[model samples]
Target: MDLNDLHGIGAGWWSRILAGFHRDAGLEPTLLELGLILAVALAVSVPRASWRYFGLFVTMVHELGHAFAALTTGRLVKGIHLRFDQSGAMMSRGSGRAGAAWTGFWGYPVPAVVGCILVLAAFSGWSSLALSVSALLLLATLLFIRNAQGAVIAVGLALASSLLVWFAPAALLGHLTLALGIGLLVGSVRDWLNLLGVHTRRRHQLANSDAHILARRTGVPSALWLAGFAAVITACWVHAGMAVAAVAGFPA
Candidate 1:
């Protein structure tokens, strides 16, 4: 056959092959993607050597929680700092007593609530919605990120999430959504447990903890504040489970 005839034959064959692959690819998550989701879930299930990364993620969420609370309650957010020592801080101004109390109150439980929402959205097949919301929150938090490291981390996360929302395939997006949702939920729970452990075992080191700050402002005991945080997180976990179960059966 001539070169033109050969070229047409090759192009037509390639197009048919691509169409076949697309037809079989489907939109649902595949077995390999599900395995990946399982792997991510297990990676963040508990506090261990790999927990440093989880801690950083939780710290970002925690600080962003405070920042959002500050802004929502009529406070002027100045900046946020995230450290490698599994700690973070948010600076704000113009917040009166009520605003301060709220900002302090939200720092602990907000991560759990956010995790719950993510889990619900992921399980309900709202992958795009989940990624979009996550990217927006990270972008909003980016405005208050003060330090170089914090800015890098926030910008990186926001960009990755934006790319996923805009370009990831449906199955890949769903898989990643579920993985991230599970990781956040597990990390938040582990953080809460760790907070309780620290507050109980190292009572003298409670000076900078959110519970201590809340206690100082509200004239309540730090232990009570810690207990309240635990209660709210527990409730959120339960409700998150229920929501996920309603959509995709109980999570194994």
Candidate 2:
């Protein structure tokens, strides 16, 4: 056997993972590639079967939003619980009402926020660093996972990111990052629309919604909270849309 194999991730792998940070991933996608990215994004987000799995990832991101936001206000994030049914909760302690509201408001719009960041990374040629950071965050999230399913999801994502960072071509990662970011952006919209549907058609599930929970907790109107989510998501979408338009050579 080779000595490099004995060392596992040899020097070459490290170089691949770090190379994009030094050099650009290159502004390289054609219009057809942009369409392909959009199509892949829609494919994962639209079909019920695909959403069944992808939704869980989105839910994880949603819960992470709450977890990190709680941490932002000096609250202890006790744990995060995620389920296969695309539902999740973050348990935190020692937050006053303002802090509570601060954490509560982060869950819905954060995936979009992340999407924009990923898009910017790809465009800015830091896609490798983006994947590396994402992998680290996924592993870090495992520490907070309270359920077996959550642990499994976090581990899987972390492993996939790690593998991609090591083996996937750095240039291709830009395209991959664009695809993932747009897919997440689409997933964010899908989740918000589902939440809106919950309020409109299924009051039974209103208790499960962040908007309603915020309203009940703060006496503010749920519609306003919903609007807040909408506003953030729309802004991300528009920003991402312009980037996508540029990538596709279209007028923004």
Instruction: Enumerate residue pairs that collide in model 1.
Output: none
TM-score against native, each model: 0.78, 0.91
Query: Which regions of candidate 2 deviate over 4 angstroms?
Result: 1-26
Q: Which prediction has the highest lDDT against the true structure?
A: 2
Candidate 1 regions exceeding 4 Å error are 1-39, 45-47, 248-252
Candidate 2 lDDT over 5-51, as tens digits, reads: 75675565556555645647445578787778779878987899999
Residue 165 miss distance in model 2 (angstroms): 1.4
Go through the candidates in order and give the clash count of each.
0, 0
Residue 121 lDDT in candidate 1: 64
lDDT of each: 0.73, 0.85
